[model samples]
Every structure is written in C-alpha cells, then in structure tokens.
Target: MRIFDPHIHMTSRTTDDYGRMAAAGVRAVVEPAFWLGQPRTNPGSFTDYFDSLVGWEPFRAAQFGIRHFATIALNPKEANDPRCRPVLELIPRYLDKDSVVAVGEIGYDAMTPEEDEAFSVQLALAVEYELPALVHTPHRDKAQGVKRTLDVVRESGISSGRVVVDHLNEVTVGEVHDTGCWMGFSIYPDTKMSPPRMVEILRAHGLERVLVNSAADWGKSDPLLTRRTGEAMLEAGFSEDDVDRVLWRNPVEFYGQSGRLDLSETADTGPLFEGSSILRGGS
Candidate 1:
C-alpha cells in the first residue's frame, strides 16, 4: 500500500532509512521543523537547519525516490530560548518557498508563557501564509496540553480543517476529534502509540481526519512504523482503502490545504547535490 508519512524528521535519519521507507511503500513525507537533541544557540542555527530542510534534506530523500517537503517554525522547545526567537522572522520567507507546506511543530513543550506566545504567533503566521499547521502536544500532561492547544487554535482564527494536532493517543484522541481538527498519532516502537493500538483507534474513531506517522527522529524511533501500522490495519481486517484513507489520503487532504503538496511522481533529482553524492569518495 502507498503511504505518505505526514510527520517525520529525515534530517536526523540516514540515507539507509530513506531506502527502507521507500521499499516499504513510503513515497512521500513531510518533515516538520523540530528541536535537535542539542540546544541551538541562535537564529542562525535555525536558518541553516531550515535551509537544509528545504535544500539538502530534500536532495537526500530524492536519492531514495522519496518526495520530501518541510514545515517551518521555531520549534516549541526552543521558543523559550531568547536567542532562538529571531528565527520567527526568518520563517515567513521560508513559508513563501514552494517546498514549505506548513508552519509547525508549533505548540507546547513546557507550556510556558514563552511557548504560548510563540504558538499563537506562528498559528497567526499559518493563517496569514495560507498554509496548514502541525501542532505538537507536550509529552507530559498531554490531555491538558491538547485542551489548551485546541483553545489556542480556536482563538487563532485558522480553520480547524487546516490544522493537525499530533502525537495524540487514546486519552487525547477524543479531545481533538470533537474539535473538527485532524488527529495525528505517531506510531513508535515503545514510547508512543504502537501499531495494534493505532488500529484499534481507527476501529473506534473511524477513518476521517486521522493521520498516522512515524515522527521518527534522533531518538529510539523507527521510520518504518507508518508501514508497520498499515500492515496491522490489514491484519485487523481493515480494507485496503481504509488503510489508504488513514495512512495516505488523510494527510493529503490536510496538507493539501497548503496548495504545496506535490505527489506528482517523485522528480528525478539526479545523483549529486552540489557536486556531492551520498557516498564515501563519490562511490
């Protein structure tokens, strides 16, 4: 079955992961800007990271025949840092670029006042830029975090149809479901929702506005979990179309609001980016 991982971090992944994902039927992915494990020192650090998201990372994904797109934002964890705040100004320019499909990873880490301001401003940016948004709920106190998130989203004036509240689980799913915003679950190997758990969610919640992703990054995450979740759906007796709606069509409908998702056959990006290949000694 074809898949479109609506949220993943290929920037922290290896080329081998891309090859595996492509072989698993992942033809496209949207990598939202997020915190690196190491704290960034300044806006320039984010500038370089954003550049790579729109530049080097896409080039790398193309090598494995995956079409890559990005979301631009000052991630929630870094929004609290005074030095990284200027990256907000840099985001609008990137949002104007063709590869940027949304403004996101923009919600709460600690749910501090600083995070609140950043979240509101970036949601406003999404509204102004006419793009979709990807909201991240705080890992702790998640139910409350999602509650406050939907509150902020309501105040932001962006339509619920244009936003996705991600990293949701059984406890938090119903909260987002009634709000008319898309619900996103990150299928992880251990820490977050697992494949069988995600299948049960689909069974209970039905398929509309549900997006399943790997959210795989620089952690103990697996990039193939999206594929694994799809397999579990089939084993649970979900029709192929049911699997497609959650794993593919839902994301397409949400991000497609940006008018930037290009699922058109992955373009031929050739073998080299800036005269360098993803190889030692140019292979």
Candidate 2:
C-alpha cells in the first residue's frame, strides 16, 4: 500500500534511508524544523537549517521519488535561550515558501513560561498566515501540556481543526482528541510509543482524524516506522482501507491544506541524489 510519513527529519538521515523508505511504500514525508539535538549557538544556524529544509532536502528527496515537505518554527526547547529571538524573527520570512506546509513542531516543552511565549507567538503567526499548525506537547505532565496547547490554539483564534496535536499517547490522547484538533502518533523505536501499543490505541480510539509517523531524526529511531505500523495493522486484522486512511490519506488531507501536497508528481523526479557518485557517472 502507498504510504505518507507525515513526520520525519530527513536532514539527519541518508539517501539510502530514503531509498529504503520508497522501496517500502512510503511515497512522501513532512520534516518539521526542530532542535538539532543540541543547542544552536547562533541565529545563523537556524537560518541555514531553514534554508536546507526548503532547498537541499527537497532536492534530495525528489531523487528517491519521495515527495518532501516541511513546517517552519522556533521549537519550544530553544525558547528559553535569550539568543532565540533572532531565529524566531527569521520564521516569518520563510513561512510562505512553497514547500512549507505548517507552522510548527512548536509548543510546550518543559511547560515553562518561555515555552508559553514562543507557543503563543507562533500560533499568532499561523493565524496571520492562515496555515495549519503542528503542535508538540511536553513529555512530562503531558495531559496538562496537551490541554495548554489546546488553550493556546483557542486563544489564538485559529480553528482547532487546523491544529495537529502530535506525539500523543494513551495518557494524553483523549484530551488531544477531545480538544477538536487532529491527533498524531509517533511510532518511535524505544522511547515515545511502541508499534504494538500504537495498534491498541487505534483499536480503542478508532481512527477518525488520526495520523501516524516515524518522527525519525538524529537519534536511535527507525526511519521505516510507518511501514512497521502498517505491518502491525495488517497483523492486527485492520483492513487495508483502515491502514491506508491512517498512514496515507490522513496526512495528505491534513498537509494538503498548505497547497503543497504533490507526491503524485514527484515519483518521476528521479534518484534521491543524482551525480553524487560513480553510480550516477560522476567524475
């Protein structure tokens, strides 16, 4: 079955990973601008990161026949740093880029006041641009964090339906779902949520406006997580139609709102990275 991994960090992965994903049925992915697994010392780092997301990464994915898209934001974990302001300033300039589909991977991290400020500001930006948002809730006090995310969305005056509350688990899924926002599940290897538990969650909650992703990045995570989830769904007695809606159709329908969903056309774009090796007849 064709699949779309709505969340992943291709910048931290290799072209080989992309090739394997394409071979496994993943046709598209959305990579959000997030903390680089370390503190970025300057705003220029953020600028370069955003540039790669809009430029190099998309070019790289096209070669593997995987459609690439992104969301731009100042992540919550970086909000506490005084140097983050300049990076935040750069976000507005690129939000309108053709490949940028949302205004997030932004929301509370430690539930700090600084996180609140960044979250509110980005929400306003989403409202001004009329773009959907991808919100990341905190790992601790998660239920409260999800509630706070919903509160901020309502206060920003953007429709709740336009927000996707991500990284949800059983402890927080009901609150996220009840908030009228779309729900996203990240099927990480050993930390976030396991594939087996994710299947149970889907069985209990029933797929309505739900999305599943790998959220893979510069970490010990699996890049082919969507496929793993699909395999699990099939084993759990879920029909192909049900699995398709969660893995493929839901993300397309969500990110399609940005006017940037074009995976169907990218399959003809050729290998993920051309002329980079002897395989492509390079010098």
Q: Using lDDT as the measure, which candidate wins?
A: 1
Alpha carbon deviation, residue 236, candidate 1 (Å)? 0.5
- Candidate 1 local lDDT, 120-139, one digit each (tens): 99999999999999999999
Give Cα-based local distance difference scores for all models: 0.90, 0.86
TM-score (all chains, Cα) for each model:
0.95, 0.94
TM-score top scorer? 1
lDDT of 2 by residue, 151-227 (tens): 88888898888889999998888887777899999999898898899999999999888989999999999988888
Worst 10 residues of 1 by lDDT: 267-276
